[model samples]
Target: MSAREEVLARLRAALAGAPPVVPAPGPVPRRQGDRPPGRPELVELLRQRLVDYRAEVHRAAGADVAGTVAAILAAAGARTLVVPAGLPADWRPGTVEVVVDEDLPAARLAGLDAVLTAAAVAVAETGTIVLDAGADQGRRALSLLPDLHVCVVRPAQVVGIVPEALDRLTPGRPLTWISGPSATSDIELSRVEGVHGPRRLHVVLTDG
Candidate 1:
């Protein structure tokens, strides 16, 4: 036999009696949602947790969503705002210049003003907001490059804890979990804000 065929024949001969490889099993599902016993409790706990993170939180009714959002932008003096493609038209404020999320480069996005979005989920116990780049939430770069971020979260989307949040999320998605504004402390224990992401984070909790 030729050299290539001889090598293949020997390899086949070597494994002829070998057992088939079996895959290891995955971990068993664990108990989740250990805090915030009820829906109302969950929402209240989420608000408290977010407040502890130093994030601005606003409560609004469903019918007043547009007005609340507009007021928030105006109060921040944001003249330019980035809107994701799937964002609801009613959520846009009429007074600001709107930029659509279209895979813009980081440098380009950094120059713009703030970004407004709806979250995929929020964890009450951890005070975390997750964005999966779905619909109202744009690509990861959109939220990261801006100096300010305003997010709208519904009470229905709030979960009691981290594991509960994970159960709602799809696997292998690009997820961004934000607790508050981007901040860090140096070796001297000096705190600084706006170093990595937005320096300001505003969350509007809707009861409707």
Candidate 2:
């Protein structure tokens, strides 16, 4: 049997006599007004949260998204960019050399300059963005290995709170929640970025 199959078989055997575990209660739902926040308000809130996390935030109209993306890459001096197969064509900057992910090796992905993706949903309150390995968002590795991650988020995808964001995601899908760039602190409280993922996060909040 394959290594993965063997591992699962062993795990199942070990749990054969184990008693069932019950899941705890979920979060208390918050009551909402008859009307949610306006789109512009949600977008602004999300931008504020992202900026507080030290992420670069840029705004663009629907027609100007491509130009905005191009400018960001140019400013970052990124030459080689990797993206998912289904990322919107207009979002890919013409100036940079864009490569589509094909289950590339980790080492190869780490060599690339940056990665661009479309977020599944974003929480305005917490400055969190979620990717569900969707068509526009590829495997988790694509975002983790690169030094720079440029994620495109639409205004419609921004939710007011965590519970609302959770309701929009599927439990079975591989989900990546990013509040900012990857960072950690040592015992001495020395902050280091990009320990587990990208060091720089650039979020493009587009009207489209």
Q: Rate the local accuracy (lDDT) of all candidates.
A: 0.86, 0.88
Residue-wise lDDT of candidate 1 within 131-197, one digit each (tens)? 9989899898998888889999988789887888888899898999999889788747966666778
**What is the Cα-based lDDT of residue 147 in candidate 2?**
91
For 84-120, candidate 2 gives per-residue lDDT tens digits of 9999888888888999999899999999999999999
Query: How many residue pairs clash in all the candidates, one count each?
Result: 0, 0
Candidate 1: misplaced stretches above 4 Å?
1-31, 34-38, 189-192
**Could you tell me every candidate's TM-score relative to the true structure?**
0.81, 0.82
Which candidate's lDDT is highest?
A: 2
lDDT of 2 at 72: 84
Clashing pairs in 1: none
Q: Model 2, 32: alpha-carbon shift in Å? A: 6.3
* Candidate 1 least-lDDT 10 residues: 29-38
